[model samples]
Target chain A: MKPAHRKIEAPRVTVDIVIFTIEEAKLKTLLIKRKFDPFKNIWALPGGFVRSKEDIYAAALRELSEESGISGVYLEQLYTFGSPKRDPRGRVITIAYFALASRQKLRIRSASDAKDAGLFSVDDLPRLAFDHKEILEKALERLGNKIQYTNVLWSLLPEYFTLGDIQRVYEIIWGKKADKRNFRKKLLSLGLLKPIGKLRKGLRRRPARLYQFKTKKYVELKRFF
Target chain B: MKPAHRKIEAPRVTVDIVIFTIEEAKLKTLLIKRKFDPFKNIWALPGGFVRSKEDIYAAALRELSEESGISGVYLEQLYTFGSPKRDPRGRVITIAYFALASRQKLRIRSASDAKDAGLFSVDDLPRLAFDHKEILEKALERLGNKIQYTNVLWSLLPEYFTLGDIQRVYEIIWGKKADKRNFRKKLLSLGLLKPIGKLRKGLRRRPARLYQFKTKKYVELKRFF
Candidate 1:
């Protein structure tokens, strides 16, 4: 009937990333020492303010590159944190992005915008600033649940990987041992992996057969997720 | 290292909702008339900027209550949207939430905040604003997948209801007619509903038996979805 009222609230929003990678048979996430006042001197996820010209995902990738110096990783939108009191100065909303990368890619060139940048084990993570620990937990839960149905685990594996490697990735992410037979059977049924007729080194027991991810299937079967 | 350069940028964040309920044998959502510069006069999900003092969930609930006048409904945090160009103005990230309610609870009190709040069928929803159309699609997909294992649909039923009522709720929400015979059998097998020895009213053919949700069992049972 009349002019609608506008909130006129310029809430500060930022993008935080939980960039995960498996290294030395353990799960690690990219962390940065805060150089700002809100959580100064504390360890936190790699993040930054969203630019007016960029979108949320772009902000996440930009923050990831600025804080961790890595790009084009398998990133997924995880959750948003808008707790009113999460930030002491004002209302700061943060969108979290979860990423998976192989151990080799963990050697990122720090963004130079943070006091320090490094990877930390999920199990022994330091106290993170502003509900990030909870955000990380939600991300892990999402990953645990999603890893069963999607081919996301491949993002944490090398270009060519064995079925055993894939199983191990699941085990580490889920923190539970899956039935090897069932896991292998389910993966094989997906029809997205082609046997490369090769074997990888560094196995105590028998080296398992290697397979390559079918990129074409990913495009055609976008519904797999 | 360089005292973390202060980025002169505005972080973008927004909120999306999957406000659904069962009404007239169909599941529906509350859509609003958007009369703004971006998506002028387009029918879109009612949402707003996240307030500084509230958490994302609280912000979602706040937006839901402000726009739909439906509060205290069981709301769940769904996911976050962060596509680079999802918002034309800037890089706006949106946190999505899904709310479930019975058909009777929705009360449209603010006609100015929302131009005629009414239930629209999920399948035949109006054109939405921003990436809200896609957000709603994802929410519906999540709901369909989740209804398979969780008793979340109970939130859409009355305190006491018939097996037929519950099955119909599932059918409407899933958009597929479920096998009535098997659906009833599976629900009963879950052992989460207790027959109250009461009969439903206003049945033309037969007065089906009424049952109360066994909340204790519902909590004890581990639902995969």
Candidate 2:
């Protein structure tokens, strides 16, 4: 309510993304080496400063493309980090997003400045710059919680997958092994997937039956772990 | 990536909140009349510009206390709306929060500048200022989705409640009548609530059994609608 309140400085905004994918039975995240000062050559999440009059979503996708050389995937906003001393340059706040994709879909053509892109396992990550580590940790918690109540795991799966295929995804993301008998019973009881009447050969040489999610898009499941 | 990007005019930040409570068997929200220009004399969600070097959560609570004259309640961060044209005075982005309180617990003591505080039903609200209507709509959607899988509805109830008491709350929220037998069966099956083994002397002189949530805090249910 004071007149001096109008003179307060505004904080700069940036957009960062945490792209996660399941590859080789491991959960991996995309990282990029910074090409500018204040963290030059240091690894960080793919992001950049928001442009004048640019929509936040546009800023997020634009940064992802410019820094990671990927485009045209949905990026869901995760959280905004606005700690006063988070950035060495100035008072900077970042709107973070998370994207889930299948390893078979990405065709990373590192756009010149993004020549040093890295995919590190969540269990073992290198030091990240500018409070990006905190942002990534929050995204990981969201991922664990999201898989609990929703069928969003569909984003990281092929068109049709076997029981072992889906169970392996859970095991990888959960960072543990699941009891096969109990896992199969619980998965079937949820009734979210349907048998396609087809089989995939060569999982221990036993033709594993393929199943597909009944819903076309991501949805909340009535039952969860 | 451009040289001029460094001076892209940072957008100002603000915090807004949606406070919902069950009053007179209806879902009501707290709003305030602006004391200054721009939206002066117009009703809007109780909020204000975030002060420089201030935490977003602190700003949210400060605005709620200064404008709505209530404090100390936990506010959950819902979403950050950063559309470029969301505000008329330059570029302003708002981080919104939502809180659910029981009507019996609230004691509204309107402060000087917030004399025109209003509590209107979410179903019948006035012409909201700025993008508040959109923000309010999003909060309502979150409220509906939240009650589906979490024990958050306990915030709107007293220490002890009967099956009918909880059922009425659901009917009010869903805006429909639920079958008595089926509702009772499904609610019991969730196993979230436990009978206290004490009957209250009321309801047509028929002693109605009371119940309490097993968990002391809000929790995500394994089974949901």
Candidate 3:
């Protein structure tokens, strides 16, 4: 009876991180091939079981680090997937996190936990295991909608960036050409960007000005969305 | 050896509905007291196991009917909770759905599945089992934010309601007073409301006019948010 009770007490939970970075003018996500059973060798989001002491966010960051050797990125809870059949192995509940980093900044040294790891464009991802395709769709929608109302785009930006660079990221993620004038006008109206007295030098076009984040505005307008 | 290779399977999934209906100018949620062990006698969201044949949304709707006497309402997925220790007895993955209905339309009758069922104001909710409180918060935030952008407010309105009535619901959910003039202007800009040839009779002074929803706008502008 005690053994049966113990068996009933255990619950399986995992964390999956949807790491988005802009590469080759496209929004890409880090995915890995599972080497074990339950969709073995199939590509899936970098994820793993949560440890006893950590919270949901910590587990996602840990799994992300373990799979791709990346850490300390801005990670937010995307959503949780608890459909009983979402996991082919047992009753596994998976919490998904969305991590944003610049494409140029991401440095992955190893795909240790996964059979292999690589970045795939969000628009044309390979077949993923489980209900990950649905999960990815939801994450993309959430991220796109969030950037419209919240300053969530900042995490995907560098400390100093050109307006065109920001516009390109939005175009890549939103899947449309944003009215450049209106996009710049609306974001600047929010008073969250500050010019840093620097300009880009090597482009064939006009030299673009660089700006840094006004961190105070983000905290002050935390509930803007 | 062949028998040892048990095919991996997803655990039995369940969807819980947190239906909110406004009554007497208060935000309330439908709660049911559990009659079985593992948080027995605890107040919880009305829910049940998802059947093998039905989808998650269907399961949530069915559970809403079983636990409470309410049916055929506006429901949307809020979030899913799958922490390993969220359930004390076993690994039961629950997908949460938030349902909206006019408070006056809610009819709660005693049911066999739940020990008790009733609408409780969000501010004064009793001790609930599982991580339902967290789910409740997420649902509330989703509703609040959704109303600001979408015409989802129609779900809480009667066939015809005054601008003030709808605005009050907004204030109650957002916990802030919106400038009445600004509020009305924004709603009017949405062009989703139609002036019906009717007047409200309960006013002490001049009677207020009633407005009906423009159904076509609901579809044409479904992606407004």
Candidate 4:
């Protein structure tokens, strides 16, 4: 086959992250307002162009930290969006990633090209720039699907959490209440949750038992899911 | 965050396809020998750079047809590989896709920048160029995982096939012998298979009952898996 002699300009590659956390029993995502032209001052997912020497994952982490002051969270490459028209500034493609973090442990501070940063309930997100609305929808679908079969919910909770806390995280992300008895039975059968030998403290009613996630057990059980 | 001051060259985005099929009870993939430098004359997954106006998925389909003359298969974006050194030709990011087709229907012909094209058993593949091996490995794992819960196996078989045909395809891809009774029981329980009230033609033994995949049933049952 003959090689085509036409030269094509490469599209700019950027990393956009959808950071999910649970706040006040609601599913929330971190968003930042852009500070420059081309969607300037509009809330968008936290991300930027990847440097030539940096790996894509590193670029994602850097942008995540620069915008929201978040680091060392459970991050995974969600998808790649390249519709030629998705970005207004010429041709641009984005490698979208989704991360899970504990809301109580995070301190949000807008920095760099972000005028402001905050966690907004996913259901009540503000108008976003670019194709961010589509990206956010896809991330939510993935998060909801993943919580059913994977142990990703552990990332959104404290080290010691009650079964009720875990169930609430599932209910909010999935947008449906799961049967408490069935949910508990399935989780215990998986053997990925270990009892902490203590009950949740400072509660007016009976304290629920606390449990911790076992990463080793999760790895083994993930295949079955 | 301040806009990154360093002017960076945009990475060339391309699409790569790992096409798979079942041949003689062995799982196989279509490979093409490259005709250009930076891995010239070496077997690799069929792909090319996305055009300025084309979507990534369209680019994958275009390259698959250009190199192997195959089209209208079950295609999905498998993953994105963008390590800085993944490609020797400067900075290039590849959006890897995998397609499934029946061996009996496809007619392979090397075209575009490919010198030759052939199907090779995945168990005994030739030395691949660039990071094609890594791409192929990930695709195999995904295909294996998907077949267990999804109706992707239908893409590797003809319109009318027996239960034994389906079981063989599963065993080859999963790399294990599935108990025949248990396999049929599980598939029937899922309600994703419909008998066509016909028998295998001209077989050396008693004719086996023919069946087809029920896409609607599979879609409904997918959420349960």
The parts of candidate 2 lying over 4 Å away from their true place are A1-5, A35-41, A107-115, A158-164, A176-216, A221-225, B1-5, B35-40, B109-115, B158-167, B177-218
- Top candidate when judged by lDDT against the true structure: 4
Model 2, position A175, has a per-residue lDDT of 81
The lDDT for every candidate, in the order shown, is: 0.75, 0.80, 0.75, 0.84
Please give, for residues A1-225, the per-residue lDDT of candidate 2 as tens digits: 123337767788888999888887899888888777777888888877777688888888887766555555546899988777788776777889988877775545455555378778998999899999999999999999888878777778777998888889998988889999998899888777899999997667979899988875667775477
| Candidate 3 lDDT, B1-225, residue by residue in tens | 013223232233568888887887889998988887778899998887666445566677787777666665688777776564677654456778888888666778656756887889998999998999998998988887677557766778778888888889888888878898988887788777888978898769788878888872223243332
lDDT (tens digit, per residue) of candidate 1 on B1-225: 123334554444567778888887777888888656678777787777776455677778888888767776678878877676776665566788888878777775544545555678886877777888888988888787767657777778778989888878877766678788887887798888999998987858888999988882223234421
RMSD of 1: 4.3
> Model 1 off-target regions past 4 Å?
A1-7, A201-205, A216-225, B1-16, B34-41, B81-93, B216-225
TM-score winner among the candidates?
4
Clashing pairs in model 2, backbone N/Cα/C closer than 3 A: none
Better of 2 and 3 by DockQ: 2
* Candidate 4: residue pairs that collide: A111-B1, A112-B1, A113-B1, A114-B1
Candidate rank order under DockQ: 4, 1, 2, 3
**DockQ of every candidate structure:** 0.43, 0.31, 0.20, 0.45
A119-156: candidate 4 lDDT, tens digit per residue: 89998989999999999999998886677667776789
Candidate 3 chain A weakest ten by summed lDDT: A1-10
